[model samples]
Target: MKKILEIIRYEYVTQVRRKGFWIGIFSIPIMIILSSGISVLAMFIGTDRTPVGYVDHSGVLASPVLPEPDGLFGESMEFIAYTDPAVARQALLDGAIQGYFVIAENYQQSGMVEYFTPDLSYDMVIGDFEDLMRHNLLQAYPETVRTRFEQGSNITVRALESTQQLNLDQWWNLVLPLVIAFLLFILIQVGGSYILQAMVTEKENRMMEILITAVTPTELMVGKTIGNLGVALTMLLVWGLCGGAVLLFLPAYALTQVSINWGVQVIAIVLFLETLIMMACLMLMAGVMATDAREAGQLTWFFGLVMSLPFIVITSVIFDPDGPMSTIMSLFPFTAFFVMPVRMTFTQVPGWQVALSIVLLAGMIALAVWLATRAMKQGMLSFSRKIKYSDLLKQRRAA
Candidate 1:
């Protein structure tokens, strides 16, 4: 036990003292910041095209300039009037007009406006322009608003609200999957590499022989896995702090569209705890499988793909939170790390499922630690050959 503590202390101190550790830990937040800055700059500096061409047969609609729609279409547009449809179409074709609009005879009665363009984008441009024209018509005819159009008082309005109203952010299905992918990728790259390298280095130096004299390999493996997990946790905490700092210090102009939720504090805590368990299991596996730095380096790539398996599984889970596949993934020790948080965000998972996942993951970690320690005990003295997956399986069977 004392020797295990020493191994833990030694691994922690050695990693913490390395320049690479600090560099790797700090670079992720800096990259996120720089990418965010570029996105903001693109949003503000992108060129806006001036809209050209307008309605000529609009005696029914008495407006000189079409009112802009709300949101992205608000006030950043231009329109030109034309008396002849053919002339306007020609002008549009000639680039004299970027787009042309035509109102049929009795346009108000027909409720028809023809907008012509060079290609398929004509439909979108016309739809936006029609919205602009309607907005202007609304200003002139405030009586045309929905309250005036509906016959009943409270019942119709309430029915409309219930049937038609939607939470726009409900459409945000992609962010959860993206977050899952990123988290799993980090788990593979950071957590798995730490495990691989730790095993590899110890074997290469033959330090395991001396260490084994004082402590069993199980104790050494447990201590190393826990210590490296501490490193992964430290990196996560630092990145979380950096993210929080950006959120807090971001300028008002940078957050025009949405307010940052401080409740993410709770979310971050949950994520940190879950990720710690996952990394611990991965590190134990790395210790068992890696014999030297070269083999560890090669295994890192394969480990990365395996870790990403959960991320691929998450897409299906997000679409149907209660689907059979999702249920299977939620119970899976390997996949639960990616699927659980997303289920929390999109759907309310039963407390029992969460509990089951935690219990299963804990058991998996314990089993991995046992296996890793056994492998280390058998393989620690030999530095001549790489540790094969088959060898580990054979040793387990022999034991």
Candidate 2:
């Protein structure tokens, strides 16, 4: 345990001190900031903020209620009332307004309105006028009814068998698990890649043989796996902090106010940890079996595909959360890291399945570690040869 802690400290310190590590961690937040700046610039550039003109023929808008001020964007379009269509058309021609909406005299019956614009360029402000019309149309209703109509409906989707409920207005809840799954995949890949690279580099340098003389192969493997994973976690932590800093200045404060499913989050975290261990062990084992870095890359590509299988069939998991495919994926060791967590967001996953997944992952992790140890012991002295998977399986059966 002391040796493992030392290895962890060495790995974390070595990685965090590297210039490449700081470069990669800072790139994400910088990209996010640049993209946000571009979006806001695009919102302001070539955008017509001209006041919109409307000729309301129907008397419903005669005493129109003042539409709510929409400061979400820079500024809301002013809905200028024109008593005459001829005057509104003249205004459009004279550049008094970008466009004018001609509400039909029988708008209450047909609910049809025609928009007239000279250049066919002012298409963005149409939605704002629709909101104004809706706001005025609801004036005849009671105050509560008007408020309800203005706010729209908050549809809550509840799972009958579980405590999971999602409000449509709060779409972040449904998407949060998927985001977590993606991040987990990224961290696992990063950790596994680092483990693979470290193992390959050390083997190329004949460092494995020199280290094994002082410690057992199993200890060396365990220490290396934990140490490299610490490096990956450190990278993730820095990236999260950078992203959190950027989120502070965003206008969408509601982005942070989403419902928190602590139970599912806890399960997702456990899944991530187990999967990370299993993947890191497998990567270390592959590094031991391969004769060189190229072979290790080829072998670990399969593991990456296995980790991404849940994402490949994610549509099915989302649409049919209780379906057989989701059930199978959630129970399977390779795909459960993502499938189970995302599935839980949509529907109630059976407790038995979650328990079984946990057990399977634990068993797989142990198997991976044992296999890695065996590969390390066999390949420790084989500087020119590679260990075959068949031999490992044969030895396993014999044992």
Candidate 3:
């Protein structure tokens, strides 16, 4: 146990110290931040915040009230009523306003308003102007009637026989599951690659012989797998910190306060850790079997493709969460990690399905560990040749 702990500490320190690891950790988040920043800057540059002049021939804007802002950031807009279309056009030409709306005399009956904008900057403010007109049109109505007309109707779907409910306001509920699954996929792939690296690098360089003198095959495998997983966890931690900071202090937009499903998150986390271990073992076996890292990568890529088949049918999972296809994928070992959480998020999945999936995954992991242990020493000791699956089983039986 002490030796395994030593191996874990050594492996964690070595991998985290690598420049590539740090680069991979920081590069993606930085790119996302920069991209989002550039997009927001471009939006601001494209906007024309100058006063917007209007020719109110219908007299609807005779008393124009300033509309409330509706965007990621506070808005600065003005709508000035004009007695003449010529004056409004001149205001646009003089750069006093980026756009002008000519309300026809029959606007109250025909609901027709002519828009003349020099640029696309008025695309966002058009809705606000319509709201202002609505507000003035409803001037004689009660406050409740005016508010309802302006706000529109929101439809919430609730099952007649059950407590199931869905609405546009709960969009984050649908997204949370996919995010959790993708995070699992990323951690498993990244951590598995490092596990392959740890084993393959040591074997090809003949360092495992030195390792073997002090540690057993099982110890080496478990320690290295866990250590690299720790490296991946460190990456997740850093990224989480960066994300938390952005959510708290982002200059462009404010994220709404959300109620997260911590229960589902905890389940996804356990599955992620177990799935990582299983994948790490398999990757270690492939690494020891291959002659070089490139060949190992090819083999792992094929394995990755097989595991990634679930993402192809993700649309089915999302739209029909309680359907048979989603349930089948939830139980399949290769697809369960990505599909199950998403299914759970979309609906109330039966407890039996979750338990069965976990049990089946445990069985798969045990089998993988057994095969990997049989191959580890034999493959590591003979770097000149590949360890055929047949040869491994036969050799293990013979021993």
Best TM-score among the predictions, by candidate number: 2
**Model 3 TM-score relative to the real fold:** 0.83
State the C-alpha lDDT per candidate: 0.63, 0.82, 0.80
Give the clashing pairs for model 3.
Answer: none
lDDT of 2 by residue, 1-399 (tens): 777677667766776788987786677557756897898888777578888888888876787776766645647777789999999999999998999998999999999899998776658777787778888888878888988888889899988876778787887778878876887788888888878877887788888778877766766777888888888788778777866785687778665666778888888878889988999999998888887898888778888888888878999999999999999999888888899988888888889999999899999999998888877777766768877888788877887
Give the per-residue lDDT digits (tens) of candidate 1, residues 1-399.
Answer: 787788788878888889999998887767766797888667545523546676657564456545434434244556777777777778888877677777766766787777676765524355556656666555655554722432223221112222322133433333634553465447445765676677777777777777778787678777887777777767777876876787688787655634332233244345445555555555555554666676666644654565567667766776787788887776676666666656655465676887787777777766766666665665677677666767778888988
Off by over 4 Å in 3: 118-122, 152-167, 239-256, 306-315, 382-399
- For each candidate in turn, give its C-alpha RMSD to the true structure in angstroms: 5.8, 3.3, 3.8
lDDT of 2: 0.82
**TM-score versus the correct structure, for each prediction:** 0.75, 0.86, 0.83
* Per-residue accuracy of model 3 over 187-302 as CA lDDT, tens digit each: 78888899898888987898878888888888898899888889989988988898788667754433543546676777777677778878988898888877679878866787
Better of 2 and 3 by TM-score: 2
Provide the lowest-lDDT 10-residue window in model 1. 156-165
User: Which wins on TM-score, candidate 1 or candidate 3?
Assistant: 3
- Model 1, position 397, has a per-residue lDDT of 90
Worst 10 residues of 3 by lDDT: 250-259
